[model samples]
Target chain A: MKLLVVRHAIAADPVEGQRDSARPLTSAGKRKFEGVVRGLKRLDVKLDLLLHSPLLRAVETADLMNALVEGETRVTSLLARAPSKALIEALDEPSVALVGHEPYVSELVAWLVTGERQLARGFPFKKGGVAWLEGEPVPGQMTLASMLTPAQLRAIGRKK
Target chain B: MRPAHRELEPASDAVEVDCSAVRIALQEHVARARDAEDSRAVHGLRVACARLDVFLRLGRRRALRDDLRWLRRSASNLRDLDVLLESSAAGELDAQTVSSLSTERTAARAAFLEVLASERCEALLDALANVPSVSAQRARAPLERLAERVRRRGEQLLDAPAEFERHHALRRALRRLRYAREWLGMDCTAIRALQDSLGALNDALVRETWISRVERPASSALASATSDSSSLVQSLSAGALHAWRATRREILELPA
Candidate 1:
């Protein structure tokens, strides 16, 4: 099985006293992440399903990908935090995309590749970055196949 | 082993020891408050002041405490009014009373803006930019001290949740603790949850107090207002008490 772990794109600056969960992606953010998605398509990336955090920013990010990937989208609190063992165990899709926030996304990548969740070992994803891994659906079983930043994705996306 | 909510909380970015970032944040909050049209801006301003107050305290900027206090106080009445108006039963109050409260709110907001525009306010924001830079390592000693006080106060508050004053004291203590944690780039959702529950309880209590002061004898409208506010007070107290019992130790004992 293969997994594409994506960090959310740049969201709007949080208005003072606004709910963090309600801050959506800015128009520019949407445009930028769309390019990233196009780039992923160019890279032959595909997904059967996309899981995202319930937070507004991540949800919007997932929506952009779903528009093109035509994948089923699901919300999980697990993506908002550390990935649970159950999350990996329950996965049925051959190609699933997990969209979420920082550190946690990186932590998941670290745990999957190294069988340990270490900040120092984690692959920090830039905003809109995606790390592609392939392996059995268990901790330390996955291998990092590819990683792409927003700029690289956008650049690749711009190609014919 | 990091807890789930710990991961959800925004881990502070690499905290630069500089005070300018904080000062700029506070100034932006103040600017928003100056033209605010909603409760959010008022709340944002209040939280900003409280956060900066803790920063000043941590850096031993004792002389500026009064300015911070004054800035916070200027908004207190308006904030209270905003909370009251936002309450569900605020509509139940007699039209005259509601009108009177609205007028008071308007005046209070004017006063608050006037204070914000004052020379003193400018000085306070200016002073913020110049607070002696505190090394992250150096902030630990005082933060640890505050943590002890918060734990002690949490114990007292849990013992006497009904004591009106203890609620205020513990709320302040928890807020200070949370801000200190933010400065050091740590967040405990438990602390944030506790503070929010306490604030809800406090808002309910303040609504009760506001009505009692303005209540008119034989006024059916006032009577309805009191009933709704009393209900809120009871429900919120139960929620706050329950939250305190559950998270008190976890949040209070969190090391600085």
Candidate 2:
């Protein structure tokens, strides 16, 4: 199985929203996410499942990617928090893309591949950055396949 | 109640010791009961086990071993019946659908109550009530043993090879870690983060499994059936994984 973990793009500050969950993606976030979609295409990556948090920023991110990838997209309550047992139980896919908030996305990546609570070093996932893990989904066994930032994708695009 | 035990220090120590022992025993029973297949028995056992575990760790009261053991056994017995009924309800047979299952479930619960009310069980409960209290210091060995058993079982499950098995195992480990954190009066924030990653991995597994096993095959079959008439169906069927990935974006857009 291949797991694509994406942190949601930059979002509006929670000040004007009733809750942080309601905050929408920033313009920069939208642009960055579009860049991410373009990058995935350039990389020739295909997804089987696209999952996102219920948050507006995550939903928008998933929407943009769904437009690009040919797969199923689902919004799940499990992605809403950093420590979601329900989300873990809900996994039954082979190639999945998850878009959610930080501390959670980073922490989840660390936990799945290491069975430890620390974040992976040097993996500074910016808005619209994508990290990929390939291999079996056993805890502490998945290998980091690749990670691409919007900047990297743009650079590659420029080269092509 | 009439005459107070004048030595506060001894009483305090006694309470601490008993509480520790009960807590250990309670957790042990809870783990065992979860493995049981009966829902009612499992529920009762889990509840009592949790109560005793919490009581010892949080309530700081020591109850007799006989009392704890009786609770465990009774809970286990109830759980067995519960599991049988639940499993029966979950069977693929036509009679096991939700509505039919409810009736069987109700009968199972009543039968369990009747079993509990029998003479032999009541006698066992009476014997349980007569257990003598021990010093707090006497509980160390049993507590350590129970903790070791839990740790070993948890490790084994977490180390399973299959993705589905590993997912469940990791979840169990997370739960145990959470329980341990609560018991030790520690923060659970880090453990919670680990759980989230595990969740994401599991989600990926599901999508991957569905595409490979179901959607892709079904799409291919449909494409083959229509291939003679149209080229579009063949093209549509060729990239099942890609198509599934595309649909995922829509699915993820739904309200969580």
Candidate 3:
């Protein structure tokens, strides 16, 4: 199975009396991620399934990617925060895409690549960054095939 | 050792890590490294150097390896200095040692800049920019070949006991195999674990060598550092060898 993990695009910083999970993607985030989706299309990215955290920004990001690629978007609680084995268990498709938040997104990438959660330290993902891994969901089984920052994706879109 | 995916790629348009893309990222990292005005920059530069080294070797682009080697050599001291200073700032190192290392680090930083500013370094960057698109064969042929190479190298490490160079050779071989597997997005945990352990052991050895190169500020401290580091290296090395043997045996036991 091939897994494409992405961090939700830019969102408004939390303020007093705001629920962190309620924050939505900024307008700029939407536009930039749209361009990124276009670029991924140029690269022939096709997702059989798209999954996202229950948070607003992540759900929106997943919906956007699903609009560009042929996939069914499903909101799951497993991707809300730090990833657990339950996150992998939720995957049933041959090719999958995940949209979530920082630290969690990068953490998942590191886990997929190294299989040790502790090694996930320092693998930070920029807002809207994406990583691709090839392997089963099994621990220590996945390989990181590619990783692209949001800027790189935008540039690829421009080039194409 | 267990082939995670029996079929590598059936799609006619399967796009792997293209050489052009890799080159572009490599160039960006080199530029970022050059603009490295802080610790993060230095860390990024060091990582880029390591990745470029592995990519160059795996692709069999021997021509560009020397340039990368020079870059890595020049940056090594700077990286260590950054780590030590970071630790010092966090109150991990004593004031005297921090003072001593800070002075040496400044000089090392200057030396690294001199190396980076050389015409040869610019030429190397230019060469990397023009690295031809990695061939499909270059990307795919290693899948099967890497498994065999890992098995062979692991066995060799087991056969040649107590030789520093032999252990180093095994480390390099495991790294090459891991890089290759990483490119293919295959399960590389077994090899990666071995490589990381070897890397830690190698780091301990490097620290010992660096201590010998510098004037001993405190003889007792120097002796203590070397003794602790050497023992750590020995234990790590033994553990790595044991792991490699187990990995090799697992691979051998798998039915074709």
TM-score of each: 0.55, 0.38, 0.51
Which residue segments of model 3 deviate by more than 4 Å? A1-160, B1-16, B37-40, B53-60, B84-97, B140-149, B219-222, B249-256
lDDT score, candidate 1, position A22: 64
lDDT for each residue of candidate 2 in B6-58, tens digit (9 for 90 to 100): 23353233433222343343344444434443454346445444434333323
Residue clash pairs of candidate 3? none
DockQ per candidate, 2 decimals: 0.01, 0.01, 0.01
Better of 2 and 3 by lDDT: 3
Minimal lDDT window, size 10, model 1 chain A: A67-76
Question: What is the iRMS for every candidate structure?
Answer: 21.5, 25.7, 21.7
Model 2, position B148: C-alpha lDDT score: 52
The segments of candidate 1 whose C-alpha lies over 4 angstroms from its true place after superposition are A1-160, B1-16, B35-38, B215-217, B254-256
Q: All predictions: root-mean-square deviation over Cα?
A: 22.4, 25.9, 21.0
Candidate 1, B1-256: lDDT as tens digits: 0111223323323233445565676677788888767667777767777777677566543335556777888989999998887764645777767777788889999999898887557645644553545555567667887788787787887788778678778888888988877766675689999889889888878777776665355687677667877888778877877887888768766544
Provide a comma-separated list of chain B TM-scores, one per candidate: 0.84, 0.38, 0.75
Model 3 C-alpha lDDT per residue in residues B1-256, reported as the tens digit of each score: 1112224452222533434444455456556656665666666555555566556544554434545667767878888777645643354334566667778888888897787666556545554553433333565554456567766766777787677666777787776666555555556676677777777777666666655565536656556656777888889889877776667645333653
Report the lDDT tens digits of candidate 3 across residue range A1-160.
Answer: 9888998988878879867776767899889998888778777789887776656677567656864546455555567668888788877888898888777887788777787777766577888888878988887788888888888888888883
Pairs that collide in candidate 1 are none
Worst 10 residues of 2 chain A by lDDT: A83-92
Model 1 has an lDDT value of 0.75
True contacts kept of each: 0.00, 0.00, 0.00
Query: Candidate 3, residue A9: CA error in Å?
Result: 48
> lDDT per residue, candidate 1, A1-160, as tens digits?
8889899999888789877776778889989998999999898877787776667677668768864455555556667667778667646788888888888888888888888887424598888999999988788888999888999999999989
Tens digits of per-residue lDDT for model 2 on A1-160? Answer: 8888888877878775246665767887778667767777777778777777666677667767765445556555456666454555445677778887777777777767786647654455778778888877665777888877778876665566
- What lDDT does candidate 2 reach at residue B76? 45
